[model samples]
Target chain A: MIQHLIVLPVVLPLVMGVLLLLTRFGSTGLKRSASVITTLLVAVVALALLLRASNGEIAYYALGDWQPPFGIVLVVDRLSALMLMLTAVLALGSVIFACGGDDEKGSNFHGLFQFQLMGINGAFLTGDLFNLFVFFEVLLLASYALLLHGGGKSRIQSAVHYVVLNLAGSALFLIAVGVLYGATGTLNMADMAARLVELPAERDGLVTAGALLLLVVFGLKAAILPLYFWLPRAYAAAPAPVAALFAIMTKVGVYAILRVYSLIFGDNAGNLSALEQPWVWWMALGTLVAGTVGVLAARDLRLLVAYLVLVSAGTLLAGVGMGTPAATASLLYYLLHTTLVTGGLFLLADMIGQQRGKAGTRIVKGRPMTQGGALATLFFIGAAAVAGLPPLSGAIGKVLLLDAAEAGQRLWLWPILLISGLAAIIALSRAGSTLFWRSQDGDRGGAALPRPQWVGVGLLLATSPLLVALAGPVNDYTRATADQLDNPDAMVNALISGNGDTP
Target chain B: MESLYAITTGVLSACGLYLTLRGRTFPVVVGLTLLSYAVNLFLFSMGGLTTDGAVVLDGAGDYADPLPQALVLTAIVIGFAMTAFAVILAMRARGDMGNDHVDGRTREDSEESRR
Candidate 1:
């Protein structure tokens, strides 16, 4: 049963992706039904995994029944299970948005979308470093296909950069894994953590170098500073639903960083403390600067949203870098908020783009409040929430993160966070002022927004407030999850001391 | 023997970095390949080289670390796939844009949008 839970997320998507590919020959109804069913099934399975993990047990499933230090392991602890659940939810939302697109392109869209989810779920669940590489490949391959699904010139150009940069990162990841394996004598994460402590002091420098190399690999994936130039361009050029999906992909990289840093490196037994602290701070600060600048400099609505993602990622990492239990909890909460809000904003941008595309104008020329009234209202609400305005999930998470940072004596991050938040608000307002506030000159004809456009934005808007209203339960869960993440002794003991027999 | 491998690793890494910082895509790819080789060798040495080491463990005397070798094998395969994907994408980009530039058409897009 435990093994089934561990494999279900990836296997379901893998089988469904293949099945969806086969069913492409069938009717449109069949593809839609298959995709909707598959996504919902994944969501349910992820929820079940989260519930199981909340019971304070770390479930490990070893491939081929091989013991530790030999077999690849799939771990479903509170942290990973939560990320899986979030991925499933965002995936479901993105699929729905995809379905709402022009039906002629639905089949190919759904197929590639499911493949991307397979990669994400696989990345979240894999327990060994090498297997994580395979999962990253799976995700990137799907992204390449999906980014080009719309087949526009801009999309293709962006996809090229996206593919090239990620391939470079993947090569570095491979080298890092090779070096790590050489030093530790094992690929199993738990085993690596155990062995890292016993390595000679002279080897510590080598180990830290290898770890930093992996950091660069994950950083590129996460869109941290210096390696993030590719993200906004690539994401902005892709179709809206695809961009929303890409939003979650970067977080998957951050999730890997968080998981590996805390569980394998930051474990009390390791010498990573000397290295992890300063590295985290520098990266986090750099991320904040990059994100803030990216958001402020964007002119396009989609590009603005993409840059805001960078900002939120930076803010979340700042919290994580603080490395306190409270900060980690705040980081987890912020992760959830940022994923949802960014995803919602991207979906809204898609709806706006579709409206603009249909209207044959660069500017929306109408009384948006009256013409696209409901959508305009919902868009503002969602955008405001994302900008960390009060009475939303984003605000709740920001407050917690700020508190945690202050408590950790990283108060200087507070100003950067505040400025970024202000910049996000300014950018959102600028885009909104152009998009929703301004009336078109009489020469330009304003078109009516479609009802389908409202549906996607409306769904996201409705979901954003729940993150705030449910903050109590969400915060508690995130806090408990962070506590477990910060101290993985229980997890390590379970994996090492499990019934002493191969499955 | 260890010192020789270290020197080789340093030289390969330097060459890889030099190539990486080049402006052209082809040279960057070459740099990446060289860097990967250096990385693999460096990782292999972490298991500590033994002249008469065997990979198999049938009571073999002083079997070299199989772990790093196993990891390097995966890395090599993945690295090859990465290089293939990158080269294909580069080909596609050049075919599309009629140039081998890495920055894509951002300048063109900005100028066109302005016009």
Candidate 2:
């Protein structure tokens, strides 16, 4: 039963996505119904997966019942399970938000959405490097379609750059994977980790080069540093729901980095002793600088939200770079907060854009915040949560990460973090104050916004406190997950011990 | 023989990088393709060069690292798809924006205009 639940999140979307494609000519009601059902099922299965993971790591299936190194594996350990849940939650929220809109541009929207979810969940769960690449392509293809769904000129222009940059990254990723397989003679991640240990020290340099290539690939996907120029333009131009979903996509890249680096490369045990600290530290610094500068440079609200996504990426990378149990826990915590808050902000951007039309520049106007009454209030709360105000989930996660960073004696990391936080607060608060407190523009009538939309905002705003309250449980779970991530030996032993089938 | 392959990969990478930094979309696409080739070659070389190593497991004295070859084969297919997609997207952007430069705005003064 537990194993069945492990595959449910990935399988459900996949089957539904294909089914949706077959029923492309179906009625709008049917398509919407199918989308809702699929999303809800995914949510339920993901919850179950999380519950099962609480017990410990679970290697749900070996492909064709073949054993390690021989067949593909899909493991649902604590990290993958948590990510699965986050993906499903965000997908559910985005789909609901999509339905709220007036337009139904095409019948294929729900299908493509589900397909993208399938890719994300598959990427998270797969234990093979080759399979990871395949799933990434799956997600990319679906995203290409969704990004251009509305087929606007600006959207297409941005999507072009987006596709090209990611394609370059994908090519680099493939090369890296090819090199790794050649060196270790296996694609299964755990098997590769084990094999890499026995190789000569010179071979370690080759492996490091390949790992760096893979890191660059994942970095582009995660919107790190120089490669991140493509993100703000592309994400800001995407449709609101699509933009919301793209929030999770970067997290997928971060997840891959965490998994591959920590499991396969970071713990090589023999050849890694010399270079580990300085290398990751520099990478973390690059991420921090790129993200803070990106956020501070933004002018529009949607662009501001996009840039904040970069900031979160920087912080997460820094946390990972610290490379301690506490640091990893903080990274995981921050990741959770960042995903929800960023998704919520993107949705809020859509709502604000719709209400104020294209003329809505900053959330703040000249003297005061704009008034949508309760809707404005809800938006403010969401924005505040994103800026890491006290009592919010973001603040709690930031404190955890800061504690870990300080303990690691990464004193230089502190100022960058403070600057990033301040920049986020300024950008978000300016937007919040302008949107909620200022009077409406004189040209526009002071008409009241609808209640249902405010209800959506309220729902998101309500999650902030709940996440904050659950911070203790969330931290405990993350710490345990981090332990498994940092040391996969026991998990690998269990798998190899079970079937002994090497592919 | 290994050194020759290494040099070829280096030159290809340089060419790719130069083209990638060009202002036009077409050059970037071409550059990316060239870069992919260089990358693939470098990855293949990592397994060490064998004269006639076949990936298929025949009575096999020593296979030239069949695993890298298998991985590279998939990568080639995926790379072609990505390049095709990117080129098509570039053409579409040209049609939509009426300009083929990577950035939608020209070299001079657009930021000021937006401000």
Candidate 3:
């Protein structure tokens, strides 16, 4: 059974999604419990997968016994396993929060949410490029539905822009994949890496174009500077739970860039080695600047949180742009901190909005919350963590990335990243004070938030301190993951050997 | 023949992109459809375009590469679903916002200098 653990992340959610769809007319409680239990199970399994991966072994599960370089395979390295765990945890939180009543507002909420998980997990795990595209589409399919869930005029508007942009992105993804396949005659990433090492000079131009095109697709996913205009509006308008799930969605793109670039075009691939680093650096810095501006400019709490996602993306991309194992490790740590905290903040925003009556998540003077004290407390911790203040995960994540930067890169990275951190502090404190302290005028406070909602928010927000507490082990894991990623030969060999796993 | 195929894909993509940039959702949906069709054709040609080639038979002489065909099939299915969803969403957006404009702004709003 453990032998099948690799495929479990993809299959379990898929099966559960179908089950939820079949029982679409059943009690909402059934769907919620079933979905939460399955997500928790996947989380546990993801933990096991991470443990198996911790030992620095590259493993793969080939579907239908079709061997690598020929058939589709799901590869589980430290990075993919770590992502599976992150996605599962985030899904658990979002699903629970949805049960607070958002799920009831839309049809197939649980089902589509599960399918989204399946797509995210599948994207993280797949070794085949085409399979990755399939997962991207799968996740997009679920997201487009979930984005329009509990449809509002703003949602439909943002969904139109989001859907149109992503459709164009999908077309670009297919073209990139096709170009790469035509050039390399293989879609398996490790295989592609191996082939890239020996690829003829004549094919270099084709490969370069394909590789860069792939970067464009992943960049859109990562919401880098130019391509990120759609993110804040779409995220701000999404149902809070769906928006939280999207916290990991951007990380999916960052992971692809990390995986594809570091593995296929690493130091071994002669001319194409680190081809994307220069592009990524400039884009990352630009994105960082843009995010800082967005963070400070945001008026609504949800929109502010959404811009924080952009800030995190910029920081993570900068780490990737630095192009060192230390930078990769640092970025992975930051990825964990940002994804969870931002997700918690999205849920927190909803909670605050609930209590504000007409004020509704905007940073304005309004009625105080019924659960004012608890909400303020959560907001305080979340703000401190997200702003890169001391005694939390965000500060450590930032310090590690800064420490990892090379001298020449440091000149560019330090000021921008620090300023972005400062921007976050300003925006978050402003939003917090407005929501908590300034709202003394109106006497409207909704009923106390639900039990599940608190539990859900607690699950995600609690991870910040936990991340700080667990920093040692987590950093070690990320460093090892980076080391594993920096060297692609192990994966190539592992795939070539049909068993492709630990003995 | 290969040039013709490439030209067709290029023209379709150009038209699709132009239409996609239009302010209205209907044009945007139609543009996306054209774009997907172009992508489908491009994917089909990725396996080294063959006029008379068999993908199913094992070890057949002059056989077409089966992988690209399989890939194209997946892309087509996904594209179809996306187009269907986009079409429905466009209608819903029209109903909700009282405009088919992509940003849901009225024609007058776009034409007017200031609100």
Candidate 4:
């Protein structure tokens, strides 16, 4: 039963979601509690998995006792466990915030929320490629509803583009998978990696084409440059809680890139890896530049935060592109910091919007807020943390990332990162001053938001510093995850040995 | 026979992409549906077409890979759902904003509002 914990994260929320859907006609109170309890349970299970995986333990759960290369498998290693924990943390925060008011606005919000978590968890844990596609659809389907949760003109408008782009992305993903399966007769990741090692040199071009196609799919999802146009508009228009949840969605794309690239097409591969390296670095840099410009040009608070999300994606991918264990480790740490801070910022932006009323989080001159001081303080912390100010996890993560880049002797990386950091700081300061300081209206104190909302934002804001406090252990875990990915032989061996064996 | 399928997929994709780039929402949705069809066909063909192959694992006759078949079947279902959702969303946008443009605002709407 303990071994079955691997599947619980996916199943718990699925069961809760169906239950919530069945009771959708009833009061939302019960549904909210059920969803919250399910998310909390998932978080606890994920934390347990993270602890178990800290020592680089790889556990494979084969459904129906079928062997690898044939049946579906779910593998939980340190990287996946970390992602699960991150998703759970963000999902918990988003759900709590949504329960405050957003969930009541839409029918089946709780059900959709639970389904979203199940999809995300499944995507992280599934060890097969086809299963990954199915989970992607599940998540996207739920997200489509969540994006339109509180029916608004702008929400549906932007969501149309978002849905269409992702549909195309899904189609591309299917094409990539089909091409990959055709090239190498396996959809299992480990088995595919093994097959690649022995594949005839003649079919290398076909395999490489499939791999590049997969890259395009993941790149689109990650919102890497030229493909990120859908993000700012869609994210800015989403309900705050949904937007906060989306903070982890882009990371899913990054995680897939890291997983697929490192495991299936490592630098150890002669021609393919060589061809991919420069392209990744150049593309990552382009993303960073685009994100920085967007941050500077954003006209509203939520849009600014949305752009910063892109910046974080760019930064993470840049580090991963460096292709060093140190770089990968720091990127993991950076992913943790960015997810928490961005989610916190989104929730905080919503609260600010609520307070400002007609001004609505726009960077223009707005009315004085009721809870100006408290909200200002929260915004300051969130902005500073995300901007990589000192004494925060963002700062630590950035420093580690820079150190890794420098160690890797990548001269151009540190400059771009530092410059982008500067630009973000300037942009965020402009936003903070415009929102908090410049406005001195007739209002003294605005209405106070509810207790749960404050707690949700506060918990999310506090998580960044907690990362700083536990920097040592978290760094060690990320380093171990990086090391594990650096050498896929252990992972491959583990999966293959588990063949035909029932635990 | 293979060339025919390949050309059909290519032509469908090209036409789908062209329509997808149109400014109107209906065209975009139709284009997406077309593109999905093309993709489904492409995925279906990946299994290497077999004329007289066993559908099961008989270990005797030539068996076309059934995995892509299953995958394509699922993809077709998802594509249908996605098309339905997109159409509804487009309808909702039109109802709410009185426009079917992707941006919810046409240039004339912006100009008139500004005036």
Candidate 5:
């Protein structure tokens, strides 16, 4: 049972998703309890994995007891464990939020949600490139279904663009993998990295092309400039709980970039060393600027929050571009803070939209709401946290990122990051004033917001202050994760490192 | 033989890309299908372009690389499912929005309909 812990994150979800699917005719109360219990179990498993990984040991569980480089392996390190924990907690919040009546609009909501969690956890845990692609499809399949849930004209429109763009992206992903495999003759990332170190000079160009192709694929996922046009509409049109769960989807792309580059193309890979640096650096800054402009341009509250996710993506990608352990640590900390808060904001926006009669989430004047004061307080806390105002998790995350940037990177990161923060604050304040303060008093018409809604919003939004309080231990964990990532030799050597390149 | 294989894959990919760029959903789905075929072929050839090789690893000369075949199989299954989903989505988009333009809008829909 103890040895099976590593695979539990992936397998438990698979089993639960299937079980939930079988109970399609079951009561919503039963389904919700089942999903909530399963997510809680996943969180507990993730916590255990996190604690074990903190010992700095790299262990991989081979499916079917198959050996490395031959059979699929699920590698657990500090980073994977951290991401798994994040996914589980975020999923828990989203699932609970859905129980507040979002699930009733669509069939198989609980089932699809569980499958989405399965795909996400699998992607975080897998060590093989091909396996990663499969998990990506798993997640994409689930996301496509979830996106169209409680469908409307707008949802249909956005889903078309999202699906088409992602299909292209997946094709590109396959081509990249094929190129890498042809050049290195292995799909296991550890094995690929080991072979790359001693790759004959003839294959350098092939490997470089593969690496760059991979960057394009991940960039599309992370919603960097030139590939982000699909994100805002798709995210904005999605149901609130579904959109909140999607907060971590971009992070998956960021994680892929970090993992592939650091492990396969790191210092030991000879000519391929840090080849992703310049491209990611320049593109990341462009994304930061683009995200800020979007924030200012946003006319809808959901669109604004979606743009905020983009800003967070850019900020994290900048840390990736910096290519230092300290920067990695800082970005990890920021990742934890940003994912939870943005997810909470989406749920809160839904609550606010519910009470606003016809204005919905559009950033315009609306009639007064019964829970205006309560909603205002939550909005203030969320906006402050997301915009990097002091005494919140966002401020701590930004400071850590700023401190990690050295002289050269600081030149660009400082002004751009600071200005983005100011933009966020300005945008959020304008939105808040239109939402809460500017509204006229009348009937205060709209159904009373449900209890589960408040609980769900609180569960996610409260993470901001909690992260601030637990800054020390969280920072240590992130710092350690960074150190572990910086050293890829441990993973490669533990795998089939000495077997040399395949034919 | 190698050049022939490479050229075929390239042409298929080029056609797929052109199709995907078209204004309608049907052509786009066909294009994605074409592209996936190209990808599967490309992935298959990655193991090497051997015609007559041992299927299993008997430790003989030119034993076939089974991994790429396995990979192509998975890709085909996944690609098939995606194509099916894309078709259904296209149908639904047309049914719901009353048009099959990829953006769910036709020319002269008025300014307010535009994003």
Candidate 6:
């Protein structure tokens, strides 16, 4: 059973999505039960895969029982499994939070949600580049529908921009894939790595151009600088649950970069290592600065969280470009920490919006709430965690990141990271004070929210301490994952001949 | 023959880029569609544009690589879906927001913000 668990993460959601669509007009209870059951199943399978990978094992599954480099193969190493586990955890929490109130916004929400998971999980699992593109489209298509699920004017407006921009990105992706296949004649990543080693120097320019085009596409998706303007608006305008689920979307772009760069282009002798792309670091710096500035300037809570997403992406990408094992390890850790914190923060922001009448999460004075005390406490915990205050997982992740950056002799990254963190603290404090501390114009309070909503937000918030408690093992796993990424020979060998021992 | 395909791809891509930069949403969708068409053509030619080549298995004569064909087929389907979604979104935006500006704001909103 465990041996066959690699495909379950994607297959379960796809099956559930079809079932939910068939019963779209059924009772809410049925849809909710089916969705939760499917999500739990996926989470269990993802955890099983994670455990299998943790013991230094790679699980490879070829669909239709065909051999790899010819068939569509699903490869599960520590890094992909780690990403899968994080995404499952976040997806489950978001679904629970959505059931609180957001699910009523549109028909077929559950179905679309499941389809979105299928896309994300498929992207994480696939070993071939073209399948990655297909899964990317699947996820984006689902996200487009989910973003508009509520059917609001603002949502539709933002969806237009998001759709157009990503369509362009997809077009570029196709061109890149064409160029790469034309030059190398293979779309399998591991096979590409092996082929790249023998690629003649004269053909280097074509491959390099293709690789950089891919970087731009991933950069746009990851919300890197100058390519990130579409994010804040789209994320801010999205419903809370959708935005929460989207916390993992940018990381998908980052994951693609990490996987492809580490596996296909991490060749020191092949002249394709990402270290040759110096602009990544500088762009990361700009992104960090831009995100921090956006955080400071944002007038609404959700938009602030969206900008913070950029901040996290920048930090992780910077760590990626640092190209050291320790840096990569810290990046993997930070990636999980921020994904949970950001998702939780978005849910909290929604709860706060409902509590404050007329203000709706905007940093302004509004009517006082009857549940002000509890909501304020929840907001403080989430905000403090995201702002990297002491005694939280965010703070620990920051320390690890800074330590790794320092070891990499990227001293300049220190000021940018620390200063951006400081700016975030200021921004969060200002927003928190305005939303919680400022008195209401009128004393007409809104209705109290459901218990499950509080529990959902609390559940996500609780992971902070849990991560801190399990910091040792988690850090070890990430370090091993990073090491595996740094040296892809074992992974390549496993896929090539299916006999190599994993790291 | 190769030059014709290349020229067509370039011309379509240039037009697509121009349309994509427009402030309105409809033109942007059209731009993306044209761009996708160009990309599909480019991808199809990646297998070396073989004429009179067999696509079936066990062909003895010269054969074009079939992988790109399969890939472009998938790309075309996805591109069509994306274009359809974009057009629907544009129509929805125009209906709900009363305008189809990419930002969902009108001329006055920008001017006021500038102030």
The CAPRI quality class of candidate 2 comes to medium
Candidate 5 ranges with C-alpha deviation above 4 Å: A23-25, A497-503, B110-115
Error of model 2, residue A219, in angstroms: 1.6
Error of 3 at A236 (Å): 0.3
The interface root-mean-square deviation of each model, in the order shown, is 2.3, 1.9, 0.5, 0.8, 0.5, 0.8
By DockQ, the better pick of 1 and 2 is 2
Q: What digit string (tens of lDDT, one per residue) describes model 2 on residues A1-503?
A: 55466667778899888888885457877777788789989988888878978877555577676666677788888999999988887877777777765227644788899999999999999989989998999899899988887777878878877877777777788778877876677888878878877887677776777788888888788877667888887888887778888999888988988888787765654665223345556676787777777677777888888888888887887776777889888989889888877887887787777667555545445322234565566667777787788878888888888888754455777777877889878767766666655655465433444443454445555667888888888889999998888776866675656642222
User: How far out, in Å, is residue A76 in model 2?
Assistant: 1.2
CAPRI accuracy category, model 1 = acceptable
| DockQ (model 4, Cα) | 0.86
What DockQ does candidate 5 have relative to the true complex?
Answer: 0.88
Task: Using DockQ, give the best candidate's number.
Answer: 3
**Alpha-carbon lDDT, every model:** 0.77, 0.77, 0.92, 0.88, 0.93, 0.88
True contacts kept of 5: 0.85
| DockQ in order | 0.45, 0.54, 0.93, 0.86, 0.88, 0.88
With a 3 Å backbone cut-off (N, CA, C), the pairs that clash in candidate 5 are: none
Model 3 TM-score, 2 decimals:
0.98
Task: Write one digit per residue (lDDT tens) for candidate 6, span A464-496.
Answer: 888899999999999999999989888788888
The residue-by-residue lDDT of candidate 1 on A119-217, one tens digit each, is 999999988888998899889888987887756667767876677677668767876876777677677777787777788778787678778888888
For candidate 5, write residues A377-450 as lDDT tens digits. 99999999999998999999999999999999999999999999999999999999999989976778688887
Which stretches of model 3 miss by more than 4 angstroms?
A23-25, A442-444, B56-60, B113-115
Model 4 interface RMSD, in angstroms? 0.8
Among these predictions, the greatest lDDT belongs to: 5
lDDT order of candidates, top first: 5, 3, 4, 6, 2, 1
- On DockQ, the stronger of 1 and 3 is 3
Label model 6 with its docking quality class.
high
Q: Can you tell me which runs of candidate 1 are displaced by over 4 Å?
A: A1-3, A102-107, A358-371, A407-410, A441-456, A499-503, B1-15, B37-46, B57-59, B105-115
Chain A superposition TM-score, candidate 5: 0.98
The TM-scores, one per candidate, come to 0.91, 0.90, 0.98, 0.97, 0.98, 0.97
Instruction: Tell me how much of the true interface, by contacts, candidate 3 captures.
Output: 0.93
- The TM-score between candidate 6 and the true structure equals 0.97
